[model samples]
Target chain A: MGPQHPSTHGVLRVILKLDGEWIVEAHPDIGYLHRSFEKMGELRTYTNGLPLTDRWDYLCAMTNNLVYSMAVEQLLEVEVPERAQYLRVIVCELNRIASHLVFIGTYGLDLGAQTPFLYCFRDRERILHIFEEICGARLTYSYIYPGGVSGDALPGWLEKVDAFLDYLPPMMREIDQLLTGNEIFILRTRNIGLISPEQAIDWSLSGPMLRASNVNFDLRKESPYQVYDRLDFSVAVAEQGDCLARYHVRVAEIGESIKMVKQCLAQIPDGPTRAKLPKTIKPPAGEVYARVDTPRGELGVYMISDGTDKPYRQKIRGPAFVNLSILSELLPGWKIADAVSILGSIDVVMGEVDR
Target chain B: MSEEEKLENTETSDKPLKPAGKASPGKALAEVTPPDPRLLALAELLQSTFGDAALESVVDRGMVTLVISPGTLLDTCQQLKTDPALSFDYLACLTSIDRQDHLEVAYNLRSLTHKHEFCLKVRLPRDTPEIPTVTSIWKGANWHEREAYDLMGIHFQGHPDLRRILLPDEWEGHPLRKYYVYEPDDVPSEQGPPEHLLIQLEGVE
Candidate 1:
């Protein structure tokens, strides 16, 4: 119903074929913001393509940046310094918290709870400020470079992050009380949008959506990368596979991410944040696939290089694009009010979906 | 003569030679695991079953890739999903590449139960690019196949609804193709999409 609906989140339209309150067939119309980033990547040097990734999934720029850069790193066969890996873990988890907060806030709005939105954004503001301090920009910080992060956290950033960590739990409790534990919210979401585990995998669902169906696969844990192999965290999972379960998985993940961030802060060593490299990134001729668990799902970069500074072809395996495609399958039996909830629960950023 | 000399002497020549530096412990840990044995066995199984359909099985840098005949894309996909040993229920990605000489459709597959992944590529001639759809096997392939059709103009033979998912319905050319040239002033060139004729093209139902 929106290239511009309040709950559609970004530029998307769904043409619903309906029988009164029930959906007969739901056809999602996307790609309104198609920038052809893949084609643009072909024209630019490998290093220049990093900035464009910031726009791919604006919510978790660090995660998106790291995924693309990791693909290039695999092709180049370069190693990220130990400290850089730690920095990546720190920033990515922080970004994950920020992204999940946005999801919870906007989702509350979608389900008709307004006060939780204010509480979420209020906490989310501290994250953006912290990000701005680290990378000089919020939202689309192109800080995660090919070899490593653009720069290390400023002098007192860790202490500031620690303070935020202490401040986060009570806020989490507040949001839970306001929305998660609210009777109305439970009535609307608990069993309304149930997806069986078979449907989850057969439709190739991932992240919270897949985990909600009780699939325990997480790329960070399953196929660990960077310093993730050393990190202590558990993948969040739920059995119901409802809108409530998706919400629960993400909320639980926020607590897990905070734990990982604290671990990085405690164990991070002082060292060079970037590796030595030539002015241009000219990876050898090869194709590599790398993926990271973004707040939404598996964000992968499939790149093919022709032993040149410019990539021959690049493909972004955007989780939002794939996750949103399941709408047609999931939406047919549900009522119209549930449409916004289901779509919001998928947690898509259209920038990635349309890219 | 020194500590370096003794270490160098111990380093085997067969090891693909670490590229010019000491790998960090993390980098060493990330050393590409050897190709999945399950996938390798699956390749042998496919080769033994469909000798002609299975064209090649390649293991590059620990990634298992299978090149199969395009005519058997649908059949191969079906077997990959249902076969209990290689229960590749998760279709990670399905995209077509315009590799100048030919169009190649690559299916990056994953199985949760088996915890393995496989890549299947089907090469198609540039002019008459057609491959049977795998929507019956994994419903997720619906949009992926539609996207391949939309961006690369690779027709999916039996996709339920293979309309242009991303591009405009009346868009002249598949912008992703290597040959697609964006001429701002000219709507159609001698070789470009027949823009004028495509106006009357209806959405494929």
Candidate 2:
């Protein structure tokens, strides 16, 4: 028997085979939120698919849109203006920060730590406010277009972002104090659900999951998509692939992302945010697998075009989907509470998981 | 019997030497794949190791996709996992294409050690699409396999447990397939009851 809670995030039913209090087998049942976004892409025009990408990873909508647009640009062989690339990097990093804040905040709530949740949401609200001012929507800003952005930055949005960064460190500290060193938090995470380096590699764990096992893999640095090659930031990694290591990795990653956002503000130049293109976009007949580092991990857009306005086929590689696979392998030996915590550490977005 | 056993062992032992590609130890996805020499060596390794099980194709992005027969998928995945030169330790993604003509499952394999990326594809008939599961090789394939099985209707032969993933238990069809269609039934016209309705009521009384 396992926790049969419905609102437990997308009708996730975990089948547990228990050895006394220890789980011997754990299986996750997903697809409750499957909207078939890929198939929908085939039916939608190139420009129309941007909004669908937003729904792919609801939490990291900007990043999803950016990845899709990047792939489209690749298929079109269009070079975006330098200014637009900088803007893309800035917004993507900001979205990454906001996404991590949700991860920390919700993870705290899941772990029974209420204070951190409020603290995280407080900072997240500021980020969302910034997003709203620029794109008119807070959560799913489908502002990114094929060549550049749909619009320019709003007045004083950069200054507001700087202020948010200035104010965030203190809030982050409070969250650290509230959970990082707490004895119970440590006990619950320290050596539990330990995934070895070899196992982590074998499982195709990316983002923080792979980083927790000491592999410093960040797609921004590796692939250098958008304006990432111009910006400088460190990839935060941990030697232990335990739940505690994953938590620390995400917290450190937020800090690094903040540093990248600051660099973007300073390096961004004055130019057109969007490129001149026709009302209809038709990319060449080809396929491309354009990847970007989202808040969760690597978000890839594998698109096949038939020299038409719509795609012949499109597949979105959701990072959460791949990361979620480790659940069954890791959850089998832990108690129910630990299972939830382990899942929290993996940081799944059911939207992406089912997409 | 002893002579035949000796010959079989030599053939297995004389398998081509797998390429030992260079790797940046600490880098994750940052590792690069050396072209030509390394890729050619990898192909040779596959040919000797799996016999005629490997089928190679060139995709639009200059990506090389290797196709494996369903019977050898599990064992082939195991070899890719353990082979040092072609250390495809990471299962980057698992997806199936719902081609109206035929169903195809694709695996994006990444070597975290050397940072090389490769793909594996397997095709199945529309009626009975099935393949061996690689969840045992890479735990990350669990949901991916399920999603492929659910939406694309491809059967994973050895998946520990396979069930409908994205659709509800009572849902009728796989939505991603090219042939999938959503149709609604005819609804009756809304109008006032006729004199026959009143007559029937009077008869019942």
Candidate 3:
């Protein structure tokens, strides 16, 4: 149905066998955007590979950077400074908010609601502006690095973030009013793409997809990393595993991210952001699998070091890639129109899917 | 169960409540913390059950890694998933690494109920790397195994629809192999417009 269709969201092609209006079978044909990032990573040094991760999931590049950096840090056994840990948490959560905002906006547009898209982008612009102030790039900020973040927060940068957090809740309410409670949005999404909890777990779904199925698994809560344990928050979950429930889970998570960021700002201590290390980064010969709870799901980085500056192997377990695999299993019985809603709920970015 | 009865029951029990390998009483508490009892128990359980099938087990970086023989990969995975003491239901990640001489596939597994995780590894000869698919045990392994097969040229014996996942089917060599060489000329470049397109342009003119 697409490598180009707007509803498919980023260059995913699905071959479907249809019976009148109902779909008999669906096979997702991905890999149109494969850049072989793993092969490229093996050719570069540990420090040089940070920027390549920015391309994996461009929506939340901060989390991608943080996860890769965590894996390298585990191998190097370097302890990040307290302030840098707080900064990592703040930026990762903010990126989560920005990524979810994109999901909500595009999801509304996919379901035939245009006003919410404009509202979501308006609020998302402020988050991008803050990111630009911190890292000088909006979409692909390689701000988080191994051992620590790239730089410390500027003099008034914390204040700027606080101001944006203050401005976000009201705008989120407006989006909720415009789309979440809309009758047409509910009618299109409520029971359209239902996934049982067992199916969600067996398929290894994560983030909002698994949470919508009532699986209370979040890496931040389960296995805290980067000052997440200090911050108090709740995982957003929904009992019904459907398109509408997934939407609700993401919307609720934006609020939780807001709470976590505010706490980071309040408890942030005055200290150095980057750690002191040798000029060359050559981790000891070993293997480690480090994972972080990204906005989409669990972004795991499995790194193998052979006592060289470059990695022996690096494998990225992208959540969108795994979440999208359930398409063929989920799309068989639904109608063609519902297929759009179901695919949109999965919210896959083809860059990660095909990488 | 009253609180006193619970305390009395614990006190009357024959087995001491102290952890299995307690340090000398003269040693300072901060000097050496003992190994985690849960991890020790898990290691014991795995060692007792798998025995010879489990080649080597090591605890490194706060994670348990069990190297299983290729012949016992599928059966070991089934038991890991179904065994109540070790319910590694979720296949977190599957990765294949090229070691220049031999190929290795690592499976990262986690049990949501127990909140414990481990790594399972299997070594195969580089030329003919093949292992039974674990998708029958955990459905999520379907794409992960396919990815390992696609990028590293590992063959799954009984995958339902094993094909190149992140690479096109016609693509030749697995790019993640240590010996793989990239040839720029291998990529097909676009020739000029097709004959049908040229004829259509002429008709329009």
Chain A only TM-scores, each candidate in turn: 0.99, 0.97, 0.99
**Maximum-lDDT candidate:** 3
Candidate 1 local distance difference test against the native: 0.84
Writing each residue's lDDT as its tens digit, candidate 3 over A118-182 gives 98898888999999999999989999988789899888999999999999999999899999889
What are the candidates' individual DockQ scores? 0.24, 0.21, 0.21
Q: Which ten residues in a row have the lowest lDDT in candidate 1 chain A?
A: A73-82
Arrange candidates by lDDT, descending: 3, 1, 2
The segments of candidate 1 whose C-alpha lies over 4 angstroms from its true place after superposition are B1-28, B32-52, B184-205
Clashing pairs in 2: A23-A332, A31-B165, A31-B166
Distance from true position, residue B91, model 3, in Å? 0.6
Sorted into a CAPRI-style docking class, model 1 comes out as acceptable
Candidate 3: CAPRI quality band? incorrect
Worst 10 contiguous positions by lDDT, candidate 2 chain A: A1-10
Error of 3 at A142 (Å): 1.0
- For model 2, the docking class works out as incorrect
Q: Predict model 2's lDDT versus the native.
A: 0.77
Q: Write the per-residue lDDT of candidate 1 for residues A228-343, one digit (tens) a residue.
A: 76678999999999999999999999999999999888878777787666688887686777889999999878788898899988888889898898898899999999998899
